[model samples]
Target: MTQTSATPLPPPEERRRLREAASLTQAQVAAQVGASRETVRAWENGRTTPRGHRKEAYAQLLSSLAAQTAAQEAVGEAEVTWRQQSTRPLTPAQAFDALYAFCAPALVRQTYLLTGRRELARESVERAFQFAWQRWPEVARDRDPAGWVRATAYDFALSPWHRFRPRYRHPEPPPADASDRALLDVLLKLPPPQRRALLLYDGVGLDLPETAAESEASTPATARRLLHARAAVADRLPALSDPTELHRRLAELASAERLRAAKPPTVRDSSERRARFWTRAAIAFTVTLIGTTALTLRTAPTRYEPPVPPGQTVLGVPPKVAPGPLSEREVELRRKLREETASGPVRLVPETR
Candidate 1:
């Protein structure tokens, strides 16, 4: 009966947060709840909720873990809890801000390496965060929100559209250090996919499978990219042959420059404003289209009317004759008459005078 009792679960996002805070994997939680990993994933993604006894088990597990996290935080002990705020219930805004603060700076730096431009790097990360804010519920419940944002940032930073923009047509200035410059040039030289794979694998310390997943490439393809990228770098800069050294150099290269990300509040505000603008624009367009359609239907001709043919002149109609030179006979006659009929003409001339 107790197992059958009604036990309301936390919101999907919070449930995920609680699980993540406890450092338990989705498979682990699913095992406890007697469900598959995908089922738990669906539950956390808000696609589906557990039923009957499973619901209570899932709820109780999250509640207990949350309590344990709170207790751990209460005492003065530095441990791997939520990276920013304590696991106590967090407002969405608070959680979002905490996540941004923890992840944005480092992500910006990583993005800067991915694209050799400070401005593009900063913009990419901010844009990615903006997207995350728009889909906060989905992103918050995601197993790795930071990775989600990172993937988004990579997509934006590596987009071919940027190349067409006048502002981003040319590459930004390279780093001052010779090694950093060479490394960046080499990175820029790599294909976008390869570049992304290398950054995820070597620079961000993601394992091969994780890197492949993030890159959206097959495992074999990702491995080839990583190998080719590493070979390219090793060829150009023998000093960075080691993967650990490459990571260190990448970090140093990114940190040596000043790449600042916008604050979370600003990013959120911008995203909200942009979303509202697009929504209003869409509404306006729909109204305009509907009105135009209505007007067209009301005023449009109901029946077909053939167009009148262009005017054509009648073939039988005569054109007026224009005077031309007189005939030779008539000219001779006129000259003879003028000479023979001089008496009447002379009288007339005297009367006129």
Candidate 2:
């Protein structure tokens, strides 16, 4: 007797949860895997089973989305826990305190890696948190608040606004060892996307697909970037030849960044600062309003001259004139036309007797 084995399938709930966690719709997953929406829904609902290539594609896509979802969920849980710690009304100050204490260091480190400027990194992280404080209610409800802040901080660090800001004379200290410096040089030389992919994948401990998502690129594109980054690094740094050594080096770099991030400048109480900011803003607004009002009054037309007393016209006003007769030249032209019409050649009519 011949026996056939059946492939085990993931649970429907698991499939649905992974899709939702990745913030993807059934249609999106179907498009990615070249399957129909109904087919994907059927698979997720356990109404049907994927076969051969479809099964493999489903498994791969599901696994990748699952990893990304897991990373985001981990951050989400941290945010939720932080929020749950206090039962009292959450104020901006209180919210900032919680987020800063929990997420600031990590964000700073991430920015530092991105920009390679310590002061810029610090400023970027602080500004991002400040924005978070301003929008605490919305941010607090975010699925991954820490990730949101990190992304904000990264964008701020790379913003062109920094060009106008005062430059720091002193640079951040370099890596202690030659190998570290070489590694940094190699990383810095890579294109932004590739570098970000490398850092997120190797340094931040995110999986390949998660790194792709974070970099805002497709998995295949991210994989290509990672390959290019690794090839460049391998060419420059012989020590990174071994996979174990490469991981160790990346871990060391991550550790160093964390250490640097830990000692950020003390954040002042935002309550007083916020109060002062609003007070200044209000005063400026009031002054501007007064100035605008005064200017309008000065520039406004004099009050309506009491409508010119009924019949009596104003001194400078001109009287209305009715249309006059045609000019002399026009009259002469009209007379000539009448004469020409009366003097026109005449034909005699012959009458039969």
Candidate 3:
């Protein structure tokens, strides 16, 4: 008979011991060691064994667990030794090292300020330490891991998708009074470039160069923007004062700026064009309307009366009378003259004959 040998099976007791040593939950260990939770469970139960890279990963995981346990045990021993050696309390530095290993007030403040989310900032710091612990050799050899950690925090804080990216979302105004409303009303009238320049410089108290940098504008451009912004605000200055009103004003300014940017430019043939196209168009329209109205009024017809009804007249007036019929005496005298004139050449005897 040929001799037969069996492959070694995973020991349930050893797997359980490794799990306990690693200070990790099954899920955590499974994730890190690239094994399924079921596979880890099987191994712990001595039902199956990992092979190839999986076996190596399993061994490394168990080793890491053992190291973590040892470190904790050592820390516990040291604490106990310290307690026995001194009845007095530990100094702040000693206490911090004992509790957190490392801590700094400036770092805390910066973490909070940058993240704007206290919890997230704290979590980030915690993860930084955890990462350092996992990769101590690398982090220890690096000359500026602290700088790297800070940069990570800042990157998280300044991400475009982060809520705190703008750092001025719905900025709280000083007060909610008439002055604020007035200030907003004035700011509303300004164009966007002017508004940005004015607010960044005057409202935010940035110097000219700083404002230009922030706005991504040239100094001369910024100055012009400020001038226009000032002119607009000044028109309503008597009423504006409150800071919250600034947002409303800025909204209006932004809208107007968008519209202006969207509007098409009027074409000019010459580079040195002095005339404003819109202004000229407006003047032309007004003149044309006036001329049309005048022409219409001049050409309108006049009303006619029937020539004052013949002889009838007004004011120092006159009137006409009908003509009389032929007189009866003239008819009888003509018959008598005819009888006497019957004689040839009747000597111009009067009709008395």
For model 2, what is the error of residue 167's alpha carbon versus the real structure, in angstroms, after optimal superposition?
2.8
Give model 3's TM-score versus the native structure: 0.22
Worst lDDT 10-window in candidate 2: 1-10
What RMSD does model 3 have? 27.5
Q: List model 3 lDDT by residue over 96-213, tens digit each.
A: 2332323322333344433334454454555444444444456555665554444444444344464454544543332245554455545445554565566656554558987776
- What TM-score does model 2 achieve against the real structure? 0.52
TM-score of each model, paired residue for residue: 0.63, 0.52, 0.22
Q: Which pairs clash in model 3?
A: 22-65, 179-241, 179-242, 180-242, 182-240, 183-240, 183-241
Candidate-wise lDDT, in order: 0.89, 0.75, 0.55
Q: Which candidate is the best by lDDT?
A: 1
Question: What lDDT tens digits, residue by residue, belong to model 1 across residues 1-353?
Answer: 66535656889999888888889999999999899999999999999988878888888888798889889777535554444446578888988999999999999999988888889989999999999999999999999999999999999998888888899987677777887788899999999888999999889999999999998889999999999999999999998999989999988888898878898999999999989999999999999999999999999999999999999978987899998899999999888778766565565443533
The lDDT of model 1 is 0.89
Candidate 2 lDDT over 13-35, as tens digits, reads 89998888777999999998889
Q: Which residue pairs of candidate 2 clash?
A: none
> Candidates sorted by TM-score, descending order?
1, 2, 3
User: What is candidate 1's CA lDDT for residue 57?
Assistant: 84
| Residue 263 CA displacement from its true place in model 3, Å | 86
What is the RMSD of candidate 1?
Answer: 17.4
